[model samples]
Target chain A: MFPALLHDALTVGAVLFVLGLVGILTRRNLIVMFLSAELMLQGISVSLVAWSRYHGDFGGQALVVFVLTVAACEAAVALVFVLQAFSRTGRLDAAAWQSLRDAEVPRRIDRELPATDAAPPVWPQLTPAGVRPRRDETAEPEREHV
Target chain B: MIAALLPTGTTPLLAAAVASGTVSLWLLLPQAPGSDWLGHRRGALGLVLGVAALAALAWAGRRLGGLGDEAVFQIVSLVAIVGGAATVVTRSPVYSAIWFALALAGVAGVLLVLGAQFLGVATIVVYAGAILVMFLFVLMLAQPSGLAPYDRVSNEPLLAAIAGGVLLALLTTSIGRLSADPPACCTIPSRADAVATAPVGPAAADALAADPLARLGRELFGRHLLAVEAAGLLLLVALVGAIAVVSRGEVAEATRKGAS
Candidate 1:
């Protein structure tokens, strides 16, 4: 039962890791790319916990604690860099920093994009509530500011 | 003829599933080649293929090694895997972050089922509660209104999908093989059995736990003391580094302005 559980958990981890890999490789959004990196970390965490469970060793669980710590530190530092990059470039696109790429690498030029055909998001509209009060023209105008 | 073309072995079937999955992912990525053929309909087709790919993956998994019998594991793992895929493919960074949170929840559930009760809860509290919220905050700070062009297109979608899918197939296959001949060093140990019977020094025995949580605490404080201190130091450095960069960057900006 435990072995089966390990195998299944590992399979799930593999799937997640792959998804993250694909995301980081394909997506051009810096934030999304970092999110993919986090997803990979998560996959590693799950695998570690599963192995720890199977072995009954505190080693795996202990490692997970360290992973959490490291991930937190990484996020803090990396997000600062991301923010800095964004400030410099005014874009969250990872491709925006291709100037830093090796000179031998081919430059990435974007192809012309077709106009967006996606429908504008439907916003909820609230119906006007309650009746408008009638103005009383008969009332005397009392206070003008001194 | 169709039956003749079908995969006869686990490896072949897994390969087939992986190939199909790669195509699905490629199609699902923003601005995939041939995506213009269907105008706005390509996304729907990709969704269909993605689901089919998942079903095939599940089938291949059952053949590779018997999947766990627990219903909860199946549900949570499915949630995690599906959420992870969505997190990757979602065009909007905000939506991606939200999907990632759901994936984190599913991971937490998987951890709980795996019996690391503390880690499971910690995953949710630390990852979902803290880290994910941070990701959302960054997205809010950085994302331009509406969709950016980068979000509407991908970098090498076909190659990326193929690479990821092939790697996944390899990993799952390796894990499946391990199940057939699990290492003798790591036999299954129940929670109570592990706690009660773990070989320990006389001093360390006192640190041994009556409960899993206490046991974890003992391990953390007792066995891994120096590592913990180092982690703390790392956190401090990260904090200082982040602040320094932000401040120095502003100073540099001011200097550049003065020079100009």
Candidate 2:
């Protein structure tokens, strides 16, 4: 029973890890890439917990505690570095720092991108906060759009 | 009905799942110019394929592992996997962070179901409460007003999807080999076997519940004290290092401005 559960849980972790791998490989945004990396770590955490259960010991869980600590530290330090990179380059795109690549490597140029069909989001306007003015009952044209 | 449609063989089911998943991911991934005409239709097809792939994967898992597990485990694991996938695929980084928080919630549920009570709650408090908030702060500080062009186009999406599919197939194939019986060659010998005489399975769970937190504390402080100390030191170093780097960058920027 324990082994069956372990197998199932491990399968879930593998899916998550693969998703993260693809995201990190393809995504250009630095923050998105970091998020994908974190996702991979989450997958590892799940597998570790499952193994700990199977072993009937604290070993896997103990290691997971350390994993959590390392993840926290990595996030703190990595975010700072990301901020520095952003300040310097003024963009979150990883390709912005292509100069860091070896000279012989061909440059990454953006291919033509499709224009988004997504409409701009409209924020609801709030009424002015103050004393309510007395409405003239005789006013004409009660149309809401007007 | 669904069972009838799926192949009885695990290999075929797994292969179908992986192939469909790869295609789904490739379609959903943000790609360059030619994608516009395919737009809404492409998204629909990808969504359909993604659902089919998830179903196939779940079926494969069930076939590989014997059934009769708690329904709650299935539900939470599904939630975690789906949320993790969303976190990877969302175009906006802020939305990606939000999806990650949802994934953390699902993971916490999985942990709780797995009987790691402390780790379960701790995952929520540490990850969703602290680390996730920090991520959100960074995103707010750095994200542009609308979607950045970079977010709309990935690097080699097709290649990435194929690579991911291959990796997943390998991992799943390996995991599927595990059964209720640990193969004699791969039997795990652990501190539990050495220290405790209690029987495993349901009885082991009862033993675990009797004093899991206390036992876990003993394991950490008694056996792994040095490692715990090292982790503490690592955290402190990361703190100081982060602050140092940020301050140094500010100073350099100031100097550069002055020189200019």
Candidate 3:
């Protein structure tokens, strides 16, 4: 006999959705933006479940399963893109990526933006193929700093 | 005249309440550079105002039916809001991810309270367990140092908050009408009533409809078969694409490094 439990649930869902939207609109970190998108998905799922329960129907639950499926796929694709973006630019900042825009449009230049502190990402160098293992006995142990 | 102006229903009250909450939440949201506006004190004020708005609206709704239900709803709702706010406001990407997980957990709790046990458990397993872990892994891979410039500052905080607040206000006003009465189209008969009243049909159909889980399975496969298949196909394509993209990136980087 819970009065307005459904309403409360809906309100909570809406709040969560808006928060996620704010996170997406504000946060520049590519990964955090993705996480915020996931948050928005969670919000929608909550509302769907609430409505499903209110009506005592299973359709909503079934739909949630499909939503989960789509989310999993999206996460996989998004992570790959994030890694690619990170590889191209050492910084995870979304602002660093502007080359994708149309050629007709001039690139945005923020004069006040702070200079990037990190060096260009260095890919691990692989030894020449079929080369014999040569231990550098004279070489000092690399300093281990994490 | 006052009553007419006030619009005597939960809709207006809920709209006002949610508007207050959203504004308070916007105020509480941490800004970059730590100085320009809306300091920590404002956040505290926002918290108080948001809670008060919800309290006042709850009073007007007159739907606080039972103690147990009310208590559970309040706890879960609070968790959801706090976790969501934390997710958005935290400076660190890792912490944001963790908070997002917490918020999703709170959502799952709400789902469970609403009797969508299956969806709740599925959400925990899929979102909390699998997706969150993957996000954490990617986050670590991308920024092993645990600090990044992008993570520190947000873009267009004021503008985004205004847009979010406006959207929340609109949604609250519309969705609040549901409290007046459940949507007539969504009304569903109880399983017992349905089974007893249904004319003798296929025994299998009747049995499937009797069990909620079975009904869900049948509905998914029976009516939404193509959608389910499409979902599975989408997953396969995504998996292959992710693997292909990662491998190609690695190879391209290796060759570039070798040439350099």
Ranked candidates, highest DockQ first:
1, 2, 3
Regions more than 4 Å wrong, model 1: A115-117, A122-146, B1-13, B32-35, B61-68, B182-210
Docking class of 1: medium
Best by lDDT: 2
Evaluate model 3: give its TM-score.
0.77
Question: Residue-wise lDDT of candidate 1 within B76-192, one digit each (tens)?
Answer: 988898889899998889999999999998999998898788988998988888888888888899889988888999999989998998798789667755665546775554553
User: What does the interface RMSD come to for each candidate?
Assistant: 2.8, 1.9, 3.5
Q: Score the docking of each candidate (DockQ).
A: 0.58, 0.58, 0.35
lDDT tens digits by residue: candidate 2, A4-97 = 6777788877888899999999999999899899889888988899888877788788988998999899999999999999998889999999
Best by TM-score: 2
Better of 1 and 3 by lDDT: 1
Clash pairs, candidate 3, are none
Lowest lDDT 10-mer window, candidate 2 chain A?
A137-146
Candidate 2 CAPRI grade: medium
Can you give the lDDT of residue B147 in candidate 2?
83
Question: What lDDT does candidate 2 reach at residue A109?
Answer: 90
For each candidate, what is chain B's TM-score? 0.82, 0.87, 0.77
